[model samples]
Target: MPDQIADPSDLRGDCAQCFGLCCVALPFARSTDFALDKPAGKPCPNLRGDHRCGIHADLREKGFTGCTVYDCFGAGQKVSQVTFGGQDWRTGTKEHARQMLDVFPVVRQLHELLWYLNEALGLSAARPVHADLRRALERTERLTRQTPQELAALDVAAHRQEVNVLLLRTSELARAGVAGKGGKGGKGGGKDRRGADLIGARLKGADLRGASLRGAYLIGADLTGADLRGADLIGADLRGADLTDADLTGAFFLTQPQLTAARGSAGTKLPESVTRPVHWTAGS
Candidate 1:
């Protein structure tokens, strides 16, 4: 597989292809993430008759910032088009709507795995296990096509665990190539800040090659020009962080949501699964 994936980000989302599933299928409580309280199966008042959010253009200004941060990884369209045969819940039978709600989350998990698997395939250093990655990718894709009944009963956590093992191996192989070589990483290699509280830390230009930052709190950190190639950023909180020229060529499990929340520039090098936010070019 090539380092650059032509359309892997398509797995991210295309709301036009969906049936407003997120607005109706999921529940939200009043909190920092959500401004209103809504129960499951209840449609958001902002949802138009055509299934588009009426406040999409000014979601954050209207206190719907949570909507902007949410990504279903293309599950909405899969459930709306494929699983439900292009049916919209507003017009579908009550039982059909119920089934659609149940199946949507399952598809989301499957698509997320697909995103990670595609990214792992893009790591040239992990070429030795490309065959295994291909097989895992096929399995995940197949599961996404299962019927609603099958999905309702699927052990998605177990499936995710299996895929995670391969991803960890892929991350190790890719990060190893940039581990040592100098600076904060020293001669032995990169630093390990896994699950550390790095919020507001001054790590600008730090050598983080091959570092495990899984579950790290990096909110508001200054990481400009950092070398983060092949780092494990599975659950790192990047809201308000600066990555002006950081190199993240092979970082594992770094989602588009994380990047959109951070500050970066055209100089920032990213892996295949992430897309640079349009606002990043506004010279903030």
Candidate 2:
């Protein structure tokens, strides 16, 4: 997992190597996640030919809260410089464009994992696997820098499986202290929501799976790449929370209202059957 304590200079707005693929590679409906409906692979209306967001200066006001939380972990540069050899999708050869398209999602997934893996390494509570986590981070970082051919042809699922094994280990180590019997975070404490104002907390790559976060205030929290599967988020205020690449496959009580109230980048994955929330419209 990559660290959430990102260098201010390395954040999304400062990245230069990527051609703003997230604005195009991902699909967006006119909802809380995007300002308009954009099919996957089609360039976003706000995306400039120069690979920048045309509305980068006022994305939030324009109903692009989800874009505000996205980060590529410098993978965009690697893809541009090393993989596709500096070819932007707009002017690249058809094969080059296809390669870029194919690898964008894969690199996005790896970069998400890298973000969490780095965070796990820095956690004092996860000391037992700190060294292992560091090694895993390095490994994932190398994987993320692969050339386009290598990345496009790679088995991303298998890579994810390999990285997940380490992430699971890291989670077990970090949460070990909180998981003891009659220890700190038991069922009784889990229900206590007093003063849990975790607004804008950097919870990237956190394993909040199955936790009862009822009524928790999670506004602007960077939950990118976090493992929130099966967590109870009922009544939690998720306004401005970044769910890019975060997994909520089995999360409970996360309704459209909650999603609308909160912000999710294009990389955010929701359960099937629920269309993208409808707050990301132009005036939303």
Candidate 3:
């Protein structure tokens, strides 16, 4: 195994080093999340000639809340600088631009896997599977470096399934140590809520310590003051969920985009992996 691990910073979005690929490659419908409809492969009207968002600072205020919460997991810079050799999409041919756009989403998925793998490797309780996590991380990193054609043809979903197995193991190993630690409702730790339909559920002040919330639909759920320490939150949809004062310290697999989509307050306790969303304290 390598002496040094991949820096977590490299797995985060750095729009300055990118050509605004997310602004061009992603599609959004005119809903509460977005101000207008946008088709895939088309540049967002707010994208400037220099590939920066014109209304970036006021995205939410402009009804483009979807844009504010979207994260490419550093795939934009990887695609722009490493994959395309820093080629500007605007200066390229139509076909060249299309190819870049096509490969962006694929690499984004791979990068996301890398993020999860990296986090898993950091868990001391998951040390037993650290070697497996490292190997998976390395493999995913290599895939992100593949050519545009190769990436476009890659079966990312299949690869993600493979990585998820190791992540699930890591979660079990880590959460095992916290088992039996009851939450606010006095529910036992390590709750199995995987893929649960928690949408609009009244879970305020609920105890969810060491819970497996993978792929759970938490849209518009009331999670205010909920205890979620050491929970596995991978793939959980937190869109419009209220998390005011929620105690999520030590939560694993919780990504920034998920936190950004939820409503929180300064009183909300969070894990070190994700920062508190600026919008959470905007008016306070």
CA lDDT of each candidate? 0.82, 0.64, 0.88
Q: Please give the ranking of all candidate structures by lDDT, highest first, separated by commas.
A: 3, 1, 2
Question: What does candidate 2's lDDT look like per residue over 51-111, in tens digits?
Answer: 8878888987999876765556555665666667777888877787778878988876776
User: For each candidate, C-alpha RMSD in Å?
Assistant: 2.9, 10.8, 2.8
The TM-score of predicted model 3 comes to 0.94
Kindly list the per-residue Cα lDDT of model 1 for residues 145-166, writing each as its tens digit: 8998999899999999999888
TM-score of each: 0.89, 0.60, 0.94
Please give the distance, in angstroms, between residue 103's alpha carbon in candidate 2 and its true position after superposition.
0.8
Order of candidate numbers by TM-score, starting with the best: 3, 1, 2
Per-candidate total of colliding backbone pairs? 0, 19, 0
lDDT agreement of model 2 with the native = 0.64
Among the numbered candidates, top TM-score falls to 3
Please provide, for model 3 over 85-178, each residue's C-alpha lDDT reduced to its tens digit, 9 standing for 90 to 100.
9999899998889999999999999999988998888888788889888899999999999998899999999999999889988888877746
